[model samples]
Target: MILAFVLLFTASGLQASKAASCLSQQQIREAIDKKQIKHLAAIKAAVRKVVRGDVVRADVCNGNSGLVYELTILSRTGTVTRAIVDARTGSVLSKGF
Candidate 1:
């Protein structure tokens, strides 16, 4: 019985973590309306200043530093760049090639 309980608890925790990581369209709109996050265009511009590339995909997620915009960009040299931008202030937080 104790083993079963532990398994159940672990499953619940994993599910909660997965749910927290996902952002729905409505949640995104609400964040924007509340001024809790910046617009995508602003995030892209901020990222572009640090990394020259065409944005291929992007997502708004809660990171260790609060809300952030994660962008995947394809550079002219055929390299991929990953950039994290502050969702609220539209600043480039980090980048990786």
Candidate 2:
């Protein structure tokens, strides 16, 4: 049981690290150049409609439909929200509070 607990802890840590890993600006630019993703500005604009807040973090990633931008927003109420925008069309795909 102790060994199982240790393995579970290690696995969770690895998953956390992987989720925390995000693409750098240079990598994002490269993806745009290659037509793999859209510009960050467009993604931000798309997300703005769903929530009123400052963007705390933005990440370019792949989704089931294709490339997407995951935006973390801090709202006026001190609440954090997550928004997913389609990189290709600059449309909001989803939002979570």
Candidate 3:
């Protein structure tokens, strides 16, 4: 039983670390600047229009090759909205309504 508990705790820790590895603060900030995202409020507003309802969570997707700002926003309606914006041009590469 003790061994099983240890294994479970270890697995949880690994999972948390794996999620953290997806994105860093510096990368998200850099992506924002590169894309010329001047205001978080504007981004949120636009996202809310498509997502509908409050944003429950937001995260940046890293290691996108040449793409930048892979924004994942979870809406209060339990919808997961994804948008990929150009890092240098502030253009929306792809978005799903």
Candidate that beats the other on TM-score, 1 or 3, i.e. the better one: 1
Decreasing lDDT order of the candidates:
1, 2, 3
Query: Between the candidate structures 1 and 2, which one is better when assessed by lDDT?
Result: 1
- Which pairs clash in the backbone of model 3? none
Instruction: Point to the candidate with the largest lDDT.
Output: 1
Model 1 TM-score on a 0 to 1 scale: 0.75
TM-score top scorer: 1
User: Cα RMSD to native, each candidate?
Assistant: 6.2, 3.9, 5.3
Candidate 1 overall Cα lDDT vs. reference?
0.86
lDDT per residue for candidate 2 within 1-97, as digits (tens), equals 9999999999999767746655667878898998777788767776777788989988877677877788889988999999888878888888986
Native-to-model Cα distance after best TM-score fit, residue 37 in candidate 2, in Å: 2.4
Model 3, span 18-88: residue lDDT tens:
57754576766775677634335555655555455554444544435553455666667677777765444
TM-score of each: 0.75, 0.72, 0.42
**Segments of candidate 2 deviating more than 4 angstroms:** 1-22
Residue 6 lDDT (model 2):
100
Model 1 C-alpha lDDT per residue in residues 1-97, reported as the tens digit of each score: 9999999999999868856895777888899999999878878877777899899988788888788887889999999988988899998888996
Deviation from native of the Cα of residue 85 in model 2, angstroms? 0.8
